[model samples]
Target: MRVCPKSTSSPLDEFLHHYMNGHDATVFIRGSRTPAKGTPAWIGALLSDLMVPVPFPSHSFDDVIKDFSLTDVDFTLPNLFAEPGSPEADPKVSGTIHVVAALPKQLNFDINVTNIRASANVSYQSHKFGELHLKKWHAANSTKVHDDVTGESDLEIYSRIKSAPLTITDSDVFSEVIQEVLFGNGDIILDADATVDVKVTTALDLPGDSLGKSLEPQISELRIIESSSAAITLSAVVNITNPAPYSASIPYINIHLLKNGSVLGNTTLRNVNITRGRNLNIPVSAIWAPEDAGLDARKTGVDLISGYLSSYNTTITAKLHPKSIPACPIIGQSLSNISINATVPRLSAPRDGHSPDNGSKTGRGKGEFIRDATFHLFTSTATFTLVSPLQYDTITLRSVNATAFWNHTEPVGEINYDYSFDAPPGASTTPRLPVDWSVGSVGYNELLGAMGGKLKLDARANITVAIGAYEETLWYVGRGIGATVRL
Candidate 1:
């Protein structure tokens, strides 16, 4: 009761039977006459099917090919690219790739792939972004395990690829890809078309193509840690959402931050580990150099600060520059052309780090300085209550020359103070400044006649103030300050 002609038991069946038997097929099936469970029957069917030239069904063959599809890749770039504090050097890339594929037991062979050189063009949404060059790779399936129960072989491939240069052909597309990763759903789909040349021991041609998708990393919690006239230092955390089963380690990464097409500062991440799920609390530091961005660097810097203080949303772009990878200047220079932008995190904490006092007449905003004033007619002196914007810093008043007016245009008296005094954070009263009365002026006569009354006076002053090692001269005007007359 043969299902097929006796001639179907040809060389292919003999070859498969011999191959399986050599690998202890008897352990699974004692004899073809009484095949234990279904192994021998399945083997016979597989052999009979092979007589039709296409031994594997089209769908089954497609499934097997899909099993070899690359799920993800892990790379250990040269130390110079991944580590910080290492001597800047542009060394060649040397790393191993582990690709695991499951195949039917009969397909298992001692295959060695050598001298593989491939170049792939990467595109997203029909737009070509770059070319990925696989300079050379050697692959060997030395670590393979056969599953007796499933009749499948798990082939573990170890491949080493070198000098795999990724050349960006379109920077705009690169930026769009980054934006998609940052703002879109966690995944980015990229189609890769590759042409490869390799010599396999069995001379089998396996054309491999894959649409790679990667999850976007999340960054949050940016805050100003330190500040000065020179630069502002910031700290943040990054949670790299790695979808793969493997992990990667980075020793250091430096990138430039840009604002409105101008370099704002440099950001650095050191000793980061990327693993499955969210890799949280990865520390990041950035140096904000508004003064060095462009010819109007200071203005740009001030605008950024002002925007932040005013609770306006702004964006900062990250880019690679020559100094991004000091040891690999050429690579850095090439990558510098590509940039990605993200919204700068809003500062949740108060800029002054204090609750606003609604009851206070002054210090309402950053611009408010003078609070109130008082005048002593007998002593011909006045004192002013001033508010400082700094929460932890202090201002030193070095010199002040001011004129008081009863009316906006009529000068009543003048104050000239040369001695320096420190005004700490919050509220402080200035020392009694000696006033030179204008005896003949109508404003002075009005002030003299109001012996025990309070008069609203306007004061304009040119003052010199210093914070730490920085000093600047500012002009201030106080309007409607209540001055109390005495004696």
Candidate 2:
């Protein structure tokens, strides 16, 4: 007989497919946020549930034959010892039997044999025997079995057979599989870049004047003159100009002439004039020699010529006068115009006496009796243009003024005066001297109106003078001059 293989579409096969595809039996099979239930292991759980041991079909049989006729009596059983107590004739027979019978009896016997054979076969059938009995009698006891065959004992087999669904529990089966799929060859890779921003700032400081010291004159010129026979006259002139927009108040102009390291003559301007917007010249002169001279007859002869001549180098020094007036009261007071001049004597020989006749011993000199004489006269002039002496304690604000001009045709009357000066310690009482002054033909209003009618003054005072020779006096000069406008 030919035997056919079990169909591939069996219950076991379906269960295994369900488990491998992730199906779950316990769950309601609804949409869930959890991992899907249609995994291979879940399908295996279904197969296991169906495969549980269940009752199998079984059959039992009993047989009995009726009395037979002559045909049945044809058969005979030969008892090797037909005697009593031989043990072979006992009703409970345990030995093998051999019998001979007639045809009719053989037929009857054959029927009985067939019936008994059928009953015995029924008792030994596979469906009638329990699995435990079959295992004990026919199959050998085995400790090891193929995983697929012994599904109950094999983990893999059990999972597949029961259609066990895949779950993200402590089990590492899914984890191992996922690792192999995602990172089996290598670790997952990624790449990225970063960015940042920044900012900065800075400040600076500059130097400024703290003591209020001003700039001195870049250059200066001085002159001196003297005579020997006549009354010794010394004269000097100092020229100072304001190089700044502000004016300077020179309280005194001190002039000193020195010869052979000694003061030959000295003069001071007690009340000096203030100079504004121009150069200032202060002149000083003094006489030191004899004022008159007499002729000596003993030393004179009939023709006598007597004259004296002496030479000496002269040095002149100047000082800026200080103010006795308090600075706080007249801090912004206007300056007064001033002119300074000095004179010195021009020396000459005295007229000669008439000669006597006969050359008498007491006769006067024939030519003019040369006599030494000295005189003092006006010789030079010094001028200074004056401006107010004020202290600029505050910062200069904005300024606006008309343009200034030189000639009368310029119509320059707008004077934006902004001057300042600081009073030195222990300064002199003499005032400044003004050398020159002139007013514009047009008034300040007329000039300003004609040229937009605006004026401003931004003045400042500073210590511009240098240390003069005389310690008894104070002197100062001016520096830094300019003009600007703002709209």
Candidate 3:
């Protein structure tokens, strides 16, 4: 049809002759035309039209072949929930799908589809797993030529599916997938068969449209509220900075706390409203279970505590699992692949009605557990002001083995206290512990020379502390300790 001569009749004439006899015909015409010598030659065009004498049945066009496929499938479910009276309050998943179609030259034209509703069966490892149902969807743009060699066009459409109702058609197979994701390489392939219903419009002629922000979540304050043999309860004030202008009501969100790639415990947030720019002071409770993660978990937990007390920055990861959001398993399954890491804020200083110099200087800062220390030289004893890192629970000092030092490295005295004493919530003074003097050392001589006066010393201690039934012994170093030499 590209070389059809201007002198020839319209190509529709041949179709008209066949149409009156109720037949379809394919026609091809090529013309040879010579232009004026030494002048540029351009081909002329033809306006061909065909009119049907009678209406054709819908099935009559079924003989025409259509080949198309879908690719670039990306699905996501935001933490947003549906409103009432619209779709079910269950969480909804949304994404875009691209369709590619290869057409013959005769039928090449732009096509637009509207009023679409579709359903698909989701399968994992050859077993039916879930269903994705779309109530309505739309594509605002027309199909455009994607590949010239194959005469293929691409159409992109987006939709928020109503609900992804999951049914574990085969429990064993589903469990295997979950087990692999948790313990193995963390990947699995899924297949889907979709059926779509839409109204299509085509034209022989054609014509010619978060610049997005993310949730910047911050932990403002963290505290140890309670503890037991298996777990410690933590309450935190989370300041979630929602940079986007949209507002959402999160009825529930549950995620697992992980340490060293192990599930330590889980945290929950409920009935929270997110708005623009810094939502402040949202109370979140978490159960920290190092016991559940194993012995190494306890060691890691101790390391975290050690780092926090030393004014070091530490972080914990909140990972989403398949059962995180119990209301919607599909959303949970989709989100379980993501791990959101957050910094564990240091514990604030206890607000007791005492200064740092309550007899001896404590140099108490945020996360500092020990407030002050006093050494009695004549009696060979020492007492310390201990700050309990708990809201309502008392911390029991089960045992103490410590050494007092002078000039950073010279030992002066040592204490070995085996009896237990309770340090209630906030600031409390420890019982005077008996110290054994290292009489021959230079530090002891310095202490003897400074009798009736106070000298700054350092102490290193292995202290065993217990809360309820949980007990852990940790090593601590105290600097600039004040010791009063008594007669």
Output the number of the TM-score-best candidate.
Answer: 3
The sequence of per-residue lDDT tens digits that candidate 1 reaches over residues 23-128 is: 3222122224443575667775655444323333222322322122123443322344444323224323334444454556556564444445556687889889
lDDT of each: 0.59, 0.22, 0.60
My TM-score estimates for the predictions, one after another, are 0.45, 0.14, 0.55
Q: All predictions: root-mean-square deviation over Cα?
A: 12.0, 58.1, 11.4
Residue 40 lDDT in model 2?
67
By summed lDDT, which 10 consecutive residues of candidate 2 come out lowest? Answer: 154-163
Candidate 1: list runs displaced more than 4 Å.
1-121, 125-173, 194-250, 257-260, 272-289, 293-295, 306-319, 327-356, 359-467, 470-487
lDDT of 2 by residue, 207-295 (tens): 11110111222111222244443333444444444322322233333433332223333455433443433444555455432123222
Q: How many collisions per candidate?
A: 0, 70, 0
Clashes of 2: 70
The best-first sequence of candidates by lDDT reads 3, 1, 2
